[model samples]
Target chain A: MREEPSQQIDRRAIRVWQLNGVVTTLVFAIITATLYIVKGQYNWPDFVSYITYGLAALTSIYLLVAIFVVPYIKWRRWRYQIYPHEIYVQRGLIIITRTVVPISRVQHVDTEQGPFLRAFKLSTVSVSTAATTHQIPALPVEEAEQLRDDIARLAGVDDDDE
Target chain B: MMNEMRHVHKLTIILYVFQGIKASAWSLIVLLFLGAGSDLNQLLNLPFTSFQLTLIILGVFLLVLIVFSWLRWYRMTYQLVNDSITIKHGVFIRHDRTIHKRRIHSINFTQSIFHQVFNLTEVQIETAGSDLEVDAVLKAIPYQEAVALKEKFLNLTNTHLVEEELPIDGEVEAVDEEQVEEEQPIIKEKKISIYHLLIAGATTGRVGAIFGIVFLLLSEIDNFLSEGDYERVVDWVSAQSIVAYFSLVFLYLLIVIIIGMIGYVNRYGRFSITRESEMLYIERGLIEKKSLSIPVSRIQAVLFKQNLFRMPFSLGAVSVELAGGEKDDKEAMQTVIFPLLRKKEWANFLKELLPEYQEDLSEMNHIPRKSFTFKALRMTIIYFVGLGVVHYFYSELVLVKLGVYLFALLGLYLLHRIPAFRRSGEQLVMQYFQVVMLSKEVAIVKKKDIQALETQGSRLARRLKLGYLNLSIMNNFLGRQFTLGFLSEEQLEEISEWYISGHHD
Candidate 1:
């Protein structure tokens, strides 16, 4: 109970999470179908198709829930707070982890864009520490840069290259 | 420089020869594995006997290795002069590295079992801020010489240390201790009771290993089974089924605990931490003894850790974060103060070890709600992957499936125990629930220790008024980073302002 409790990440980020979920489902479905069709031509055992079909059912259920049910929950859960002295992050619905990064300890701050995030006109701010790297994924591009600058400003890192 | 280039102990030749043999043997093994030496005639497309040529080539390679080893041994020399240590070594190209005495954080004297047989020990020195690198390693020095070098490197001479050196190491004649009273009698903690050591050992990793061996034996149970053995087992099972099941389980538990106890007792035998002057000396190990000396100032951090069972009993372990050590090298006793300590005992222990470490914050606050949600995604990913892998391996095992489900419950419970941080001026204080054992760890680090600080955000987190912040302090090559997510936007801005505002001057 060291860091103060705080808020969630941008709600719009869930749309990207949803999109990611759907893309994964599509990819999984495509791979399974291609494998089944190719293996079918080689007179594969009939039971093998049954296994693939069972897998398809499981993947569908998983992806469907991920795309439909998870995005909102994820949006609601992502939260962080920063004080003059320390930065606090707590996220994770399943195995919740909370990290407290002291402002005085920050080394570098930057923003990153993935293909999907770029399409959505979004960027993710990345914070680097000696041991591990932290990311705040899915902010509008300008906002992401601003956040990076703000963190760099706070951490007193003058070599700001954003 | 030429006049000062003195030869090392003559035994270095023997050390080099052994090393050369080990290297050449590994290379030969690799060549054989690659099938390059299977049939020399076939490999070389030769007309005459290739077996003799292959033998000749191998002999030549071995000879070259020996020559190179000898040259390396001959060239390797170190000197302690001008308040610095310089080690100059290399066969083809020369390397002369000198480190000033002030930067020398630690000088450890070590002796492997083989070295002990030869009455030789190695002295390794580490300069400050050089991660994973030793300033100099003077190998195969006599024990007395190594001790003297350690003292001269640090400019300390204590006869008490000499008297205490090589405890129970049969051959070293006991030194007269009449003047030992002149030095402050080195403080020694009570030797850990065998009972507590046994308890701690059972709770260590050995229990898991014992269970693994038991399960492996069970998998091979069919190999021991014949028709008569099966019939006898069935007859006993039918006669006293419930009693037999309980007895078997009890026997299994007993065996695992015994195995763990044996391992811990053997390894941590005569575990002792003694403070003499400005350094802490750790002496442990049953068979091949190890004695090490670490200066107090070189300690970076203290980690108070507890496994799942230990937490319930308030019996946690503490390991010091050393500033410089080689990567993945297991100097177990050096890192550990002791394997088991009651929660009530930590304050006194830390007071003895690190007087500068203290934390007191005037006010505190909780992390924002989004912190949990954002981190939940990361945690869920690990659990999901773990479950998927376990399911793939043991889909039909109902017990294993139940265990996986049980782990999920544990995971959820852990998620609820996310850590928080507090800071007062220059020091950051944090208390977090470490996933391993659901143990709570409170860490206090100074602002000056921090190497980096940063904050990041995904679009959705920003929408939900969330951000991720991470900061690190230099400890090892990879600094220790602490992260907490889902802070409000206002908090992030305030933090940024505070961090950058005062540092400009």
Candidate 2:
């Protein structure tokens, strides 16, 4: 059973991933720069003579492609099938992984907005079960709240024995 | 009898002083021994006349300090009001503390050999937090008052005598003083006698004590041999024939069994269990007396275990899992229920204690017959591979090692498949939830206690829509881990749903 308009998660998650990639690259750049400066003081070698510089360059390129391009493509292909009984999330880059969480087992659902996400007016939804926790990151704030209420209502009702 | 409550037996403080002196003496001796090889002779370089004087002066100083500490502690006193137990002590600090009866999860009373001789008891109340333990409520309260206070605290309904019941916002109305007095029962359940101690000792605690002794002996032997004399000992043993070796092994096992028996008898020398309306009380100990009471609702889980050796004796150990109970240093499993029982009596006892979980056993699911081949093959292969690695490393002794490998592999294969695993709908009805690892433990936890559930898929399982479900529960000290493995995806989902529904309810 599917809703009339196939439910699509907010596309802001792509931006969140892209931002994460940029922040990670900056952190590595600062660390590498410090090491290179330290090596120069010790007369070790130039930055180009170091193997780590080449590895860092490769990592930067990989992160750029993965963070921006991959998540965007996946988000385009992603489809969430949410029903009264269960919520199924399907998305992947190369190999698709589908997770089905039953509403009965949903212990609690939280809608969190970090400073960065709040600036973008986006919220992350986290659902905790007895044994696992799942997150749907960077949805529209309004949509995340709706999803939280719907899950809570579904969990509150006792329909299993039937 | 009332006089006993006011003054703690004089012997307790004396014993404390003695113990402190012993510890201090050991420390000084160790320091002196370590200093013997060092260039510290100058610091200790005293004239013979001065050395003798110094020794005498130091000894007197130590004695005075020990006596002072003992006297300060001796004056410490504690009393149990209707709702709270107050402890007041400390020579300089003058610390005064009170623990409410309602907040206390378990009350444990311990009497060491010295306390026992003086007819005194030490009571400890365990509360919810991790930071502090209320160790000395009444260090040497009269044994009878200790028992009465223990019973009073254990019975939740008799809260008026301990403390005025805190007013709930909207639920319980305050009761009058007359009603509170009427509720106090003069005679509580009689203190469990020494007989019950034997039963408890014969079961789990005794077995643990035996194992501890064996471990200690083994370590001592290792130490002695490692000191460069082991080669000589080994040469002497090697002079014996193969038959002699076998007999020596047999003798070792016999000695271990005898030690186990002694441990059991000593620990459970005087076991007793009495049930009040609100709690189950258990008291057992030989030289060191132990009394513990667990409330009915606070009991989280109950577990039963039966090893192959215990099968013949028709004996099993039943342990209760409760929150806020002191975890033993050795065993992580917190048992608040009956510690041991005959298998036949377990069903009746469990039903009496926890009627909510008692269910028809036939409805439970045993491990499917189809799963037997998988389990057997997996265990056998693991054993073979492990033995193969050992063999490869010690190829110089291949023949003898090969025989050992074969024997181990066969034994493991039989153990894995013979018993067969079983699970009831949501509740574990039988003693079958054991993981066949280094130490096998059977756990029976309520669905609500499960903290998290995870389903992992391999490449193949991902395709087949089948995966492994790992259920993590909060372990007292270890934080959280799981009794996890492969299961049918559908079954995993159903179990997850069941746990979720249970939590919501």
Candidate 3:
């Protein structure tokens, strides 16, 4: 088997993911509350009330897993490395995917940061080739910028038509 | 050398009129058939009778179309300035697009019957851009003038190639057509004979598709015809005797086959491929003559395809994925280089046409046999679980369950037998089946053209040492991925290693 990539994403990625999970859990909480409201307003059958209870239970379970479990495992699994000629990325929770993108084939590189990522002082480095784009997400802001610039410089050294 | 803007031939107006009618044909049909003679006529309270009203509407629509076409034809113009072509178009927006000769990938000339009547041809210029439309088009130009422009553009592109010092293959010399005009001999040529066209049409495997389309059209016809009329037509059909019914069935089959043959012959009647210098020229079509010129370097990948109907006869076709062109016109981007070639002749065909991809495909490594059982089990688990749920709802569908099971087994068997892969130096050859009918596709793509390589494995697959390999190549603005599943880890590792390091240990 090939060796695993040497680098991991920023440690703060877990917290960011948990924050996202909290927002999703909030949405689920609203849905469960709405179902409860509808059942009472319409004098719905016992089955409706039972469905609401089932949804509430599922939501609570999801809240615990998403905030407490999934992010950490996801962050732990994400690994990447920058070789002289190619970029190696391995990521996934259950179905692991390893991608190798040659620097020569790269069309461009970019650093992007959403509001949450910006709040955490993190950014995503997206390397685009002619056919596909691979992102190394949740890197420190400065590191992401440096990585983008490095990839851009390396990609410029080779020229070919798409 | 013409720097001044020039409009297309005046015939473009007439062509645009036909185009406008074609674009709004469905609305016209509804207006005429459903509205004119129906309650809509009384609701409108027009001065004339329904028949006169319909005539007036048709007349007004025709007049509008003629006026609009004239305006459009008058507004669009093209010019050649230095090494670039500029098209000034749009009836209101006045859009101007300039494409350099260096970016030109191919130029196609199409002569429709109308254009033939006027001794004009339509010139479509394609560039290596991500535009959904051909970069530029001269709707109608004198045939001789278009040919001269094509040569000039090709020569300019060749001059740019020389300046760039690209690694053109030694055999495919990028010579200046201007200098070699006297001695530009055809290096190789192939033509499809009438007998081959008959075979190609018979094995096209489009009969099922055509039957479906015909039935769909008949179903749509119910909307126009009243229920009584529809019943009468059905009764007339059912009223035939057994002998008449048999003859009717025979006639239908004959008509379907004849329709298929006519379509195939019309599209590829005089099909011919010619190679000269660094370009491959394809000329085909009967009613509408089409000729295309593609440079050798622009070919992204080569595909050998065998449909289910043709597989039994060992017949297949060769197609190539070009780097850039309009995707709306399916033929523009992925072109069939050869319409028909026997299995044994494939290597020879590739050697003669695309020598860079010529390789011994016989030595490919098949996927591990054990992986078949794993995949088949996975498919069965998912399908049967769904089937069991369906059985709970529709318990009497035992025959349906059997049919589904048999179909799934056949699919698994075909999937298990087909997949093969090989990595030879710069080229990676992958053979697999697609399109739900076990139509075999063998694709050869260069490593340099591949934008990314991905290997994926689920937990179960990881334990079994099986994985999937996907290679992405540029198709228009997006990447098109070709995937091979159930490959052993060793095969994946060796391929990935070769891709990453450009060599194997």
True contacts kept of each: 0.24, 0.12, 0.92
lDDT, residue A144, candidate 1: 79
Model 1 lDDT per residue over B157-247, tens place: 3452444444565533434344445445546454577777888887775477688998898778867899789778768767886878899
Clashing pairs in 3: none
Cα distance off (Å), candidate 3, residue B504: 12
Q: Pick the DockQ winner.
A: 3
Q: Residue A77 CA error for candidate 3 (Å)?
A: 2.3
Ranking of all predicted structures according to lDDT, beginning with the best and ending with the worst:
3, 1, 2
> lDDT per residue, candidate 3, B127-240, as tens digits?
887776647888999999898788778844455445444456652354544436635454888898889888888777676767667668767997999999999988998998
TM-score of 3: 0.86
State the lDDT at B64 in candidate 2: 84
Put down candidate 2 lDDT per residue, A9-63, tens digits, no spaces.
7777777767777777788777777777777778875654465677578668878
All candidates' chain B TM-scores are 0.68, 0.72, 0.86
Off by over 4 Å in 3: A19-69, A158-162, B27-58, B155-186, B218-251, B331-333, B383-407, B436-438, B503-505
Q: Per-residue lDDT of B20-93 in model 2, one digit per residue for the tens? A: 66878876676555543243435666554544544655677677877776776666766556567767677777
Which scores greater on DockQ, model 2 or model 3?
3
